[model samples]
Every structure is written in C-alpha cells, then in structure tokens.
Target: MRYIFILTVLLLSFNTFSQPISWVEQTSGLTTQLTSVSVVNDNNAWICGYAGRVLRTTNGGANWVSVNAAPIPLTLDLHSIFAIDSMTALVAGSGSSSFLFRTSNGGANWTQVFTETGGFINSVQMGNAFAGFMMGDPVGGRWSLWGTTNAGLTWDSTNFYLPQAGTEAGWNNAFFFEVTSGVWFGTNNTRVYKSLTLVNWTTQPTTGQVNSYAIWFNTPLTGFTGGTALLMTTNSGLTWVSPASPLPGTANLSGITGFGSQWVVTRQASAIYLSPDNGATWSTSYTAPAGNFRHIAKSRANNLIYYGVRSNGGISKGTLLVGIEPVSNIVPDKFELKQNYPNPFNPNTTIEFSIAKNSIVKLAVYDALGREVNSLLNSELKAGEYSINFSAADLPSGTYFYKLSTGDFVQTKKMILVK
Candidate 1:
C-alpha cells in the first residue's frame, strides 16, 4: 500500500501540476487581514490592506516592509491592488476617495494620483501600462466601472449595471486578468459580471452570493472567485459554478492564486486550501496566523505566488503548487482554436482557441521552411476558449504555420507575414 501511494504521488508529480502551499510571516506583524497582493518577476510585489497601508516586497515574500503611503493612514481601507508595471500601480480603498497611487521606480516611492472623493474602490486592474479601471458597489448615484487611460491623469465612466431591485446594478469589486479578460463581482443584488474590453459587460451567474474577493483565469476560461462558496467558472465568465469550498460555513472568499497545478484559497482566519484538480477538491496550505485574505497573484515571470491578508502583513513564495490534471477527451469539435487575426500582419497578431477540458497542450509557430520559431500553448490549459497575442517583431515578412498538438491530435494553419 505504501508503494502504491508513492507511485501515485510520483505520477501526479510528473504531470504538469499542483502542490500544497506554505508561507512565512510578514514584518509589521499585524494580525489584521492583508487584503491585496501583486507580484512582478520574483522579487517585486505589493500588498495592501486596512488602515490605509501598503506593503512592498523585494525578496519575494520572505520578509516585508510596510509603506505608509496614505497621508492620513486611518482614514481609508484599501480593498484592491493592481500593478501595471514594476512602478505603475493603482490601489482602491474603502470610502469615496479612491486612493489612486503610482510609483515610478518599482515601489521605492509612491505619489498620489487621483482620489475619487465619494465612492470607495472595491477592485482595480490595469488595462495597459497607461489604461486601467476601478469598480465599486453602487454609490452616489449609479456608477460601477471607471477607466483611466492617461496614467491615472483622467477618467471615463461605465455603468457595470444599473441597480435593479433583486439585481443590484453595481458590483462589489472588479479585477482584470489581462487587458481584455476582466471580472466584476459584488454582494447584495449583483453577483459578478465579465468583459473583454472595458466596453461591453455581461453578468456571470454565480452559485451563491459572494462578498469578498476572487482570482480568475490562470489562463482564460479557468477562474475562481472567492465568495460564499468558492464560485468557479470553466468558460471565462460564460458560466459560473458553485463548488464545495474549504471554508466551514458561509464565509467571505478573498485571496486566490495558482502556481503549477495547485490553487490556494484564503478566508478570514480560515486555513488556506491548495487544490490540484481545478478546485474539484481542496486541502490545507497554511492556517493564517490571523486576518482575512484580500488579494493574491502568481508571478508568471517567475514561479512565485504572493499573498496578502487583511492585516497579516504580506507574504510571498518563490515556488508554486505542482499538481496537474490528466490530459482528457482530446476531442476536436469539443474545442475551437480560432485562426490568427490579421493573418497578414507586420509585427503583432492574435491567435484564439478553445479547450473542452483541462490538458497539457502544445501550440507552436513554424516557418514556411518547417522550422519552428515560437510556441504558445506550452503549459496546462483550463477548459475554455482563449486568444493570445503573437508578436513577430524579430521575424521577416513571409508565410508561417502555427499549429496546435495534443497527445496524437494535431491541427495546423497557414498565416502570411506582411511587414
């Protein structure tokens, strides 16, 4: 029996996958919930929270030094954190003053950008280095999403939804995984909604009511929002499913992140759970010493998973979860990988595809001579359709072939490169 168990562990480890998470402590050592976290490369990350505080990490999360950015610390409570670049960031705190701050030199220092003096910011995501947005629950009149394209210099408004009786028009929070893929969720009437650009927004039906935070799409189509019962989605936000979460009862789900195959979920004071099978099941990672989870992020540049609780300081990891699901149902019609947009482009183009199930797949670009130049689908993919940008800045204008291969199934298409 011991050998069998060992073999199973070995097999699961070999697959592109997940493992449990372990974390250290923060410096300030506040037992308050550390609400938000963001990581770049492996060393740089930022965590924000209650009492108008933001914590920065340069050595992953081994240790953290608290940065008191707010002029008036006790006035606002930060709810969300977004790092567009090493230096550029946007922080949303509770209350009307959307405490928007920016750092030019990788958080060494920060400057106050814009402050929405009325409604508090619930969540924030960078649309680009220049453009980003912040969302909050219905406040003042009827506004949900706000956009800033000029490096927080100016703004635009969006009605995430108009308040309805049973259906609240406003969102509890908002976060963007990419320039296109974004999600906005709330408590009372509004559950959550999704959008590609900042333009058209669609409400995604969640399992139950969520109050806290959510982490979405390790890659698109696969996302988990932390709320009532760990709401999950296989299709970006086309549909939402309520899965059995690790929390004991009706608890607010906040921080969530994925490393390798393991996903970590945190609730206030509740032990974090690491899942290998896409949240189908969950186990403990580490019990938070105190505080509630507010934000989480996985550094793609490196494998570090950074986390922040309401007031637990901020912690980060150099390694990530390693549990992966089996490659299943390699069915063609089950998925639809769209052709590259602007087939005959000079520098950049977009490639889109869909998967019916989670699997380790390969997507590569080949020149007309059959020599492979680039590969995109090189990691474990969650079930859903997605589009990725393929920038050909180094290649000459010509014809190329981009293909998708999984197990024995292979598909290829011809693309023209016009410089």
Candidate 2:
C-alpha cells in the first residue's frame, strides 16, 4: 500500500467562521454507550463504549483518563479504537463474544491481541506501526477479515477474500482503512466494500444507500457515508451519490469522522451536521441530547473534533471554525467560486475565484459521473483577486467536479484526488 503523488501547497489565510457549530461537553464519568473514537492529535484522544469503557485524552478534551481493561473485564463491549500515538493503542470488542486488545503503556496495560467467540468487532484500523486492520460481523457468512503486520503481535484471518452474501454484517463504526486506499466497509446489504490491496476485493451497490451506517475517507477518492441514506463516493467506492440529508430529521446515519476539508456528521438520534464544503452543505453542527450517536473523531493533531453521545453516556469536545474570516483588505463583491482549498486533495490543491468584471474565462473539470476530466482555464482575465494551481498528477483516487464559466457566471465545486 504505497502510492505517492505528492505536492501539497495550501497557504490560504483569510480566517472565516460561522454556521451552526457548537459542541463542548466533555466529562465521561461513564454512563455507558460510547461506541468508538480514536484521535491521536490535538492533545491525544481515545474512547470506547458500553461496559468495557476505555476513555483517554491527552489535553484537547481537557481531562479524561479512565483506562483499565485488565484481563479484559468490565463485561466487554468496547466497539473499536485504534489510537496509534500518545503511546500506542488498539482495541476491539463486542459483548457476548469477540475481543482484541493491545497497548504499549498508554492504557497502562492490555494485551489480548485476539479472541473469538461468536462474532462481533466492527472496526479497528491502523496503517502503520506494523500495519493493521480488523473488521467483523459475519463469521460463517464471511465478512470478517483480520491482518496485522506485527504491531498487534500476530493476526491474519487467512490472507483475504470476502464475498459471501446472505446477511452480511458490519457497521458499528463501519470500518475504513487507508495506507494508500485499501479497506472500506458498510454492509447490512446495501453494500459498499472496497480494497485497493487488502487482498483484492470489491463491491458496490448502495444505489439509494440505506444501512450504510458510517464509512469515511477524506482521500482515496473522497468518501463519506451513513445508514439509510446520505452517501457520497468520489469514485473510491466505485460509484455512489446522494448527498443532502445531513439530518433533515434523520436518514439514520451514525458516526463519520473528518479530514480533507472539515466534516462531522452523525444523525441517528438526530442532528450533528457541520461540513465546511467538503460535503456540499450542512449546518447544525451538534445537537444530541437524547440517545443515539455512535462516533465522530477528528484531530490530526490540531483540528480537534470528538464526540460520541450514546444518549446520555456522553463525551464531547469541539473546535471547528470553518475558516474564512480574517479580512482587512478584502476585495470581491459578485462572481465567486471559492471552495477548493485543501479539500480531500493530495497532489496539489488550490483554486480561488473572484472576478466581478473581466470576461472570457472557463476553467473546467468534472468526473464523478459528469465526465470532462480536466481543463484548468480558457482565459481573458483581469478582475481583482485570483488563485489557481490545481493538479492531480494524472488522476486516480476519485471525485472531481469543477466548473467556473465566466460570462453568465456559472459555478461548481468539489475536488478530491487522493493518490
């Protein structure tokens, strides 16, 4: 899993912030129900759920440190966690059965590595520190692949090959890995499986998408998902589209992290949207007081965003600005397209627009089923402020859609290459 098409230049500093964004409530003295969360930045973070709870936070969340699973007790239910930083990590569980634990001092002590009883272990991913991957749900009906280069000691659910149908399972935190674009999950039938090289596998069929229950990828062709509806696959999942519904009442989505361009979606027990363009549109950043949210973790060291409120068991932390504010000498009143800076991009990303008067211009790119791969610009500028330097190398990851026209002032935005 090694594909590198580098070139990342993002130096935008206008500072902007607005939108229904607000979430701050962290103090998990445990009430149960935290399904999952793993953030190794912005101060370190880690969380699990139900009975075998295992919370942690280095600083970002203020203060939270309750880690003790000793011989794996407390009844077991830790959905999944793979923190790989603030001192190594890896966790997995599922009530009446299933297990896998590992720690290197951070959690004080843990070391079960693997276990099996009936079925259960919905997600756990680790791309370095000795490779990693674990996803489960269908024991006999297939769908349960494990692999660990070494970190977790030893594991290898037998090479690979997942196709069994009949009642496939998976969707707790809906597993998704990326060491170059390799694992992905979300199945309860609606389908959505992929594998760049986690042992060759591929599936697609979330047509209208339902039961997709959380699957994320900000690169590897940009992805996002949630059960019953709400889906978007810039090509990584093969083909999937239907994005709007961050929480119009509820299509029943559950946990989805963020990266490329901020994101945080969770709508099972209702609201918690928040997308700074990477998801088209979304607002109500956080709103869950009753009982159902499973996961949402992002903190690539500073972005900071964590939440998992299984109804009262609570756990929250926030820091989402949506950047766009700093303005002293701003300029531009009419024509604008700006929405493509650092967006799920890899291999260069930067595109700004603001031509209020000048004429003849084109700039094109589309592919997420729209065709028209690349065009860049067509020319006759001179308006005020501009910024363009888009590059995808040769394209491969997925999701693309850019249009700018000039005369009547058309617009279109969405970019992701991830290769």
Candidate 3:
C-alpha cells in the first residue's frame, strides 16, 4: 500500500509538470481577413485587415473596437500596422492606390500621411515614437521606400536610393529594422536587400529560388527568412542554408517573431510552429480548424506572450513556457541535478537543477560514443532553482548522457531519444 501511494504521487507530479503548451483562440468579431497585428504592450494591441478594418484592444484583447469607419474608406485593403501606443498607430494600405494613415487620438480621426499612385506599401516600422520607415514595391525603377523622422507627420524619399531588380516586388510585412543596425527586407527576386546606413543598399542571395516573405534577425549575422522556403543565415546574410530538421507543413510561412532563443512562426495554413532553442528544432504549437494564420506579433511588455492573427478574423494567443525558466528565487542549500522529465523523450524534454551559490555552470550532452553532441548551457547563474529545455531533434534515436557541472559539484544522467 505504501509503495503504491508513492508511485501514484510521483506520476501525478510528473503529469502536472509536463502540461502541453498551446495557443488559445480569441474572439475578434469580424469576418475580414486580418493581414497584420501589432502589440504595443501587455494591455494594448491593434489588428488591421481587408475593407480598411482596424480593431484596437486596450484591455489586452478582452474587447476589440473597430476604429476605421469614417476617415478611412471601406474599399482600402490595409496590409500592415505599427502601434506606438494605445492611441498612436500607423496603417499602410496596398494595391492600386497605396496609402498610409496615422491616428493620434486612438482612432476617432485619421490623417493620410503618404500615398503613391501605383506602388504597394508592404511594411511600416517605427524605431520609436518619432523615427520610422515605410517599405513598398518598386516604382519608376526604384524601390518605393520612405523615412519619417518627425513621427508620421511627414515622409522623406530623398535620403535613400534603392534600385529594384527586374520585376521584383516586396511582400506584406516582410521587413526587419534595428535602429542601430539599419534595415533588411526580402523580395521575390531571390534576393534580400540590406542597408546598414539606410542610404546605400546591398543584396544577398538566399539558398534557393525562394520568395522571401518573412525576415527576422536575432543579430545582424544570424537570421531566418521564410516564404516559398525556410532559409537561415549565420554570416550577416552572406550565405544561407536550410535547417537540419524540416518544418512540419508544406504551406508557405507568413510570419516570424522571437524573444531571446525562443521563436514562433506562422504558416499560411492553419498551423503555427515554435522552437525553444532558436531554430534547432520545431514543433507545431497550435492549429486552427478553419482559415489560416497570416501574421504573428509579440508583446513589448512581456516576452512570453504572443498573438497570431488569422485570415478570417480569428486571434490566437500563445505563451512560450518551454525555455530556461527560473523556478525559485530562494537560494538552495546544496547543488544538485534532477533527472530529466519523460526519461524516454522523443525530441524535447525539461532538465531541472539547483545551484547552492553563484557559480559558472556547464551542461552538455554526449552520444553513446562519447562525442559531444550538444551544449545546452555555459553561463554564470545565481543560487536558485532553474529549469532548462533540451531538444534533440537533429540527432538520431539513441541512448545519450547529459552532464551538469557547477563549481566542484558534477553529475551525469542518462536519457533516451526514441525517435
């Protein structure tokens, strides 16, 4: 009786610790295909879609109010949006008469800041409250790009000259901007245009003949682009390669966003993929029964929270809970490494440990032949309980060993990858 009770309690504890992470659906109350979503903070976000529809949620999506009826025409197709705050935002519409609109009073009124006759506005990004850039398809043999320094009150087209490739065009929300490192945007010509000074541009070829739609960089050197194909670069866009583990679906990828080493990508179909260790491995975190997820956004106030917008007015929220998480702030009395959860994990598992004092730690994995297969951690940490996620997606099924060492305490444990 005593042995059975202990086993039951252990099983229950394991089940509680390994709860699956997922995306919960939210009500957006519209049927238009939402093209973009921008999250300003934990409590504020904005979504824009076809029919010039704009929805603002000040209370973290508890309710969304339509803010584009009077000044903005119903025939406009808003492609991208950037929210500066709960009240200030800019939306760009594409197609024959591409236009950019700005709202300062939370959407009661809007001002048309910029418009072009034939070009298409693909993206609008703000470095802050004042400085921003708008990217568009090429026109008159040049990429239709503009920059605004005084918020969205005015735009300048004289500072940069980006010549476009023959018949090349930009995709919606397909650019990345870092204030200190400049900007990058992908195109349909199997090229990615980058500008360090936002004045002179250079183009780099991806791995294959691909239509690059989603571009994101953790740093200037390491980045990923997805559209017709998923490609990654580690040498500042000098070269690109495919990841070892292929993504699950065949649909084209539409959006990519990340916080630290965690990444979330949306497909043009009904699925969203998540990677806990950068792009080393991926899993389908959520899938809708109908429609497709067009773009994804991460909250500026919280790194864990993410919002994914569907084509047919659906909103899904997901939290990244499978990374290196600090479990306790209380200092531990001794150093120890607990066995990993789900001993025979397929490709993902959690490893928990405790540190007695501030120390440099190294946790690594080795294959049966004693070859170092992966390096999970090599950093200094304070005395506390920590949980780390380990992914073996690229490795073959085999018995492996993981070692945790801090200060003079060292321990090794065995785990199995069944697939």
Candidate 4:
C-alpha cells in the first residue's frame, strides 16, 4: 500500500465550532510508555513504545493484540513505527546500537533491515510505497540519514545528502516528508532544517524556543512546529511566529497532525489541544484521566477520526462530528452546484453543492485548459447539502474551473484566483 502524506483541504458544511468530539479510551492491556501511533485506515492501526512493545488493532481498536513475542528484543525502546498495513510495518528503536526492523507476517517473524552502533533513530517516514527516509542522531559528526526506494527491503546510507550536525540531535517522530514538498525536521538547538531537493539544505531558527519536537504542514506554504513553544509559518519555513494565544497547558507538545482547518496536537500533559481554524487558536478537546499523551495520529481514510497514545499504555479514540450534515431534515429535490464563496479568492475558497440521492460524488478543480488539478471530494456520500473548502496556495494566480459529477449528474463552474 502506498502511503502519501498529503493534507487534503476539504471542510463539510457544518458548524465546526459547536462540533462535539467524543473520545473513548481503548484498552491496550499494557503499562509501558507508548511512544508512537500510526493509523493505516479506519479499521487498522498500530502503536509502538518502550521495551520493544508493539501492538496492532485490526478492528478499529475494539481489540488490540500484542505482536512482540519472539525474535524481537525486549530491551529495545521502540520510538517510531510506520505501518504499511496490518501485516507489514517498519519500526525503529533507540539504544546503544539503534536498530530498524521490518516485519511482513504480522510481526510473527522479523528481519533486521538496518543497524547502526551508537546511534538513535528518531523518525521513519515513507513518501510512498517505494521511497522512504529515516533520520537518526548525528553519528560521527554527520547526520545519520538513510533512504530506501525498495519499500524498506533494503536501505542505503550513502548517495543521499544531508548537512553535518554540530552537537545537535533530533527528537523522536519529529520529521515531516511529502514527495513534492521535500522534508523537514526539528532539533534541540532551536533550529529547523529543511531541504527541498534533499541535497541542498537550509536552516531557520525558531527564535526564543529551545526545542522543536513536533512539526506538521497543512499546505506547502503553511505549517507549525511545537515543543517547549509553538511556532507557525504562513510562508513555508522562511519565517516562524508564535500564535496569538498560547496552548492550554505548559507541557511540551509531542505530536501534531490534522486536515483542513481542523488541527490536533498532543502535549506532554493529559490534555489534547485542537484548533478549529488552522492554528490561530486552540482549546482543550480532551483530557485523560491518568498519564500524558506521547503521540497522536489521524486516520488516512477518515479525517474525522484519530488516535492518541498515552505515556501509560492508554489509547484514546476520538471522533469528530464534522461530517456533511444536512441543512434541513428534508432531502434536496434536485442536484445543485452553488457558486464558490468569496469568488476571486486569495488562496482559499469554499464550494457548496447538493445531491438529490445517495451517490458516489466527485468534485475536482481544473486549470484553464481543463486539466484536473485538485480533487476535493470523491466519495460515496448520502443525499445532503455539503460544502468543501479548497486551498490554492500551491497554484499560480489564474482562472480555474471546478466540476461536480455523479453517476447521472454533472456540472462545472468557473472560479478565479487573485494571488
């Protein structure tokens, strides 16, 4: 399965401010400090943590099975995990000799893919099914960066380029990668390094912040990094600034992930903060009863559902009630495509539509030449009124066309981008 880390910008027509999120704590049946969580889909998920503990849930966290039995060392503290599916995954652990393990048979057997003595692998991310990257602490003054093009079957340490590290180290799960956007990672030295080409590098200081442990981007030009403090950027990473209001807690942020205007972050404390309007403001969405959260992840198949792992073996499943709610109880009599809000939009706009019956709908944007550019919606939705927000930050200013299509219905409209 190819995993592409692209944040799709689409908002359903609902009052997100009043949308209630209900979180239920799932039973992990362990007490170890869970470090990272990965949601492959709505039904499959994985969590890794200390003592080489790895857990898997195939039925949407209704039951979690322990997959760390044989051939997996009990002393390794697994820091990060990338789940390709329920039966295949790659996990990296930090120790005197850092190790990367890949399991193809649901963790019943494992193969050591990469190992480096005196190294600590912090993050492992796959851009797609074939290409991936892994980063560890500086080894012998050079960043221990590895790239793999064969789906983690083998890894290459050389040929891939990175800058030297001068006594700085990266935090666990502190990296972001998008095939078209490049890679970024934060460090303990108040600096974040970015490379568009993966060879030429540049650094930007997160001024006044000592550490940046978590980083996420909604678009190529908008992102956020958090640790001891929270910093945001509107023009990529060229500049960073703190939000107008501070996060609810004083603890460091350990995980960050979201889609569209909805943002979620897990702090070192018991609370998970959420921003309904892109990172401008935050409010406490859920507070655990016992330990702090170490990592949070959103489902790739469903944006409204996410999972957060705690420091005490607790997994919380949160569901956001932000789906396409009907404008009224009555279903529409005919299909309609409304004009996009704030036409001649500057980088962002909302397109509304309605369907007369349940159908598989597709809404997409096209360039002036009728080439498909962005796919906003392509799913089986019930008959209702819906609106989706689209971002054109990565597109040049020009005239664009948006088309809505179903099995028996099709419509197209024009919109303009000013900048």
lDDT of candidates 1 onward, in order: 0.59, 0.71, 0.78, 0.81
lDDT by residue (tens digit), candidate 2, 1-419: 11122211121223322222335567778777787888887688888776777888887666888886697788877788888888888888877678888888889898987887787888878888899888888787676788889887778888676866887787777877878878888887888788888788878888776578888887788788757567787878788877654445555777877776656777667456666566665555555556677777777565534555565578766554333233333446678888888989877788877766644556678889998765455433434456666767667898888998876799998888887
By TM-score, highest first, what's the ranking? Answer: 4, 3, 1, 2
lDDT per residue as tens, model 3, 313-360: 998866444333333336768888889888899778878777787566
Task: Please identify model 1 stretches exceeding 4 Å from their true place.
Answer: 1-17, 29-33, 70-74, 106-109, 158-174, 210-212, 244-250, 259-261, 310-318, 321-419
Model 1 Cα displacement at 189 (Å)? 2.0
lDDT of model 3, residue 193: 90
The RMSD of every model to the true structure, in order and in angstroms, is: 15.1, 19.3, 14.5, 14.5
lDDT of 2: 0.71
TM-score of 1: 0.64
Clashes of each: 31, 11, 0, 0
Error of 1 at 273 (Å): 0.7
- Per-residue CA lDDT of model 1 for 1-419, tens digit only, reads 00000000122223344533335445655655567776766667777777877776676554677665535356777767776665666666766556666666655566776566666666776656787777765555655567777777566784454443353544323355466555454444435656666566666666555443555566676777755667676777666676654444456665666743457666655456667777656555555555555555677465545554544553434244233233443333465557888878877787766666655556778989999776443444445454556778778889999888765457888889897
Off by over 4 Å in 2: 1-37, 45-80, 83-88, 92-99, 107-110, 117-120, 124-135, 139-165, 175-186, 191-207, 210-241, 244-255, 258-274, 281-297, 300-419
lDDT of 2 at 210: 53
> Against the true structure, whose lDDT is highest?
4
